[model samples]
Target: MAHPVRSDAEVLSVASEGVYHRLVLSARDAAPRVRPGHFATLAVGGPQSAMLLRRAFSIHRADVEAGTVELVVAERGEGTRELARARPGDRLDLIAPLGTPFPLPDGPVSALLVAADYGSAPLLALGEEIKRRGGQVGFILGAATADRLYGVEQARALTQDVLVVTEDGSAGLQGLVTDPLAQAVKAIDATVVHACGPMPMLREVSAIALGLGVRCHTAVEAAMACGVGICMTCVLPVVGEDGVSRFVRSCTDGPVFDGARVRWDDIGTVPPDLEGAAAMGGQG
Candidate 1:
């Protein structure tokens, strides 16, 4: 497990991405321990407001030396709209550096990074780390359209090997990122596949990796009223070492998990075989 930090920091900058924005902040306490899959809960409406729930975001990038953090946020709701409009000096409260990070490879090896739309937030840090260990990286970025694509250029710059895919044919390949994933993996002989995005995309990525006998790790996304473990709102069905299937909190236990271990086929609803599962409706 990684350490976490709670602090009130100043917004450093905001970069526009059509209706989306990349929100960056200066947080001395959070930047140090933050990892690739870690996330933060932000107080969106400020200190006093009817919108009491804090919004959760993946830690896009953090600099311990510079005391800063970045979040790639979409302006889809009131909370995110507020964050998008945040200025250079506005104070924002953040509980951060949460969750375990992607495991670093033992030695140099080729890798593939898969992302969906804005889900590219966490991959840059991971890509940098992979490169640091003398590994090569290839990317498969997917989106609805070219306008929806996030960090394509940044990804290209870092890895020098990226393939773009969109449903509207507005980018590199006109289709799902998975369309060319298996071929890409084979071409590069990627030994590991790391992904961060929608569950459906993660599921497909995992299948591809498993078919190729490559390891897959994922940072999953779930809707949550609270970003911590108490709510039980973001539970997932995962098999433990004991070979027992049980509900686990995505907020605490993982936003990241071994892709092969996740019960992907039964994700949207509860597992009927689980104990006491039927009493409460859809979960895990």
Candidate 2:
């Protein structure tokens, strides 16, 4: 899809829920350009601007009929804090529909959607897409605690079964969310496993999916300065079909990637097998 229309989008509303803030924007053209995993960048600077950087956030929800798009943000810093303070009718500049989206299966197939923390944002739209394709969606969502879990209620409403877990046993299950992923996929007879969350969680999910002999896709969470690939800070190692691992920018190449194709173990440090990666310890 083409990039989202850059506009002085109006803030329709702002609401706060446990561990997250939901901001609704009156960007009528945004919905048409966005897909499930695509994200947005919002300029939070005001006149005589104290904060100059635009903040990137995942598109949590959208209502085309209502002419609006929503973002679920965790106010961990100044940029998001300013965004959270926005009121109705405030104008915010935005660039969106960024990055690749999760691919839909060629044929309708059962899926297991996994979410950690606020990662549930993308899966809601993905679930709708799955149902539209005559497929079923089963969810396995987890967080540090029940209050931190993003969309358990919504997931339950959309599908027949949802498994929720929290670290302290404050919610459905007591252990890590990954603890039940394999069993959940088996129970649903899922063909695909889709995940979005912290790198640690994604890594574990990828491993579990591989062990179960299922296809997996992941949406990586990276901090982007430009969100449009203008800055190269979000690059990571991705293995291509030619058997070469090259650094690809997550903002444009993907925030979403084929789980198997991503060089998971070599993500943080470039591996020697890569064609031109520097071998600091020894010269080949």
> What tens-digit string does per-residue lDDT give for candidate 2 at 1-284?
43767878899889988879998998788877778888888987675787877888888877888878899989889888888888999999988778888888676889999999999998988998898888999999999998899978889988977999999999999999899998999999999999999888988999999999999999999888888888888888888888788888899988998888888888778678776767543665
Backbone clashes, candidate 1: 0
Model 1 lDDT, full chain set: 0.86
Candidate 1 local lDDT, 47-147, one digit each (tens): 68888988988889999889999998987888888888899989898888776678888779898999989888899888988898899999899899888
Model 2 residue-pair collision total: 0
Q: Tell me how far the alpha carbon of residue 166 in candidate 2 is from the true structure, in angstroms, after superposition.
A: 0.3
Top candidate when judged by lDDT against the true structure: 2
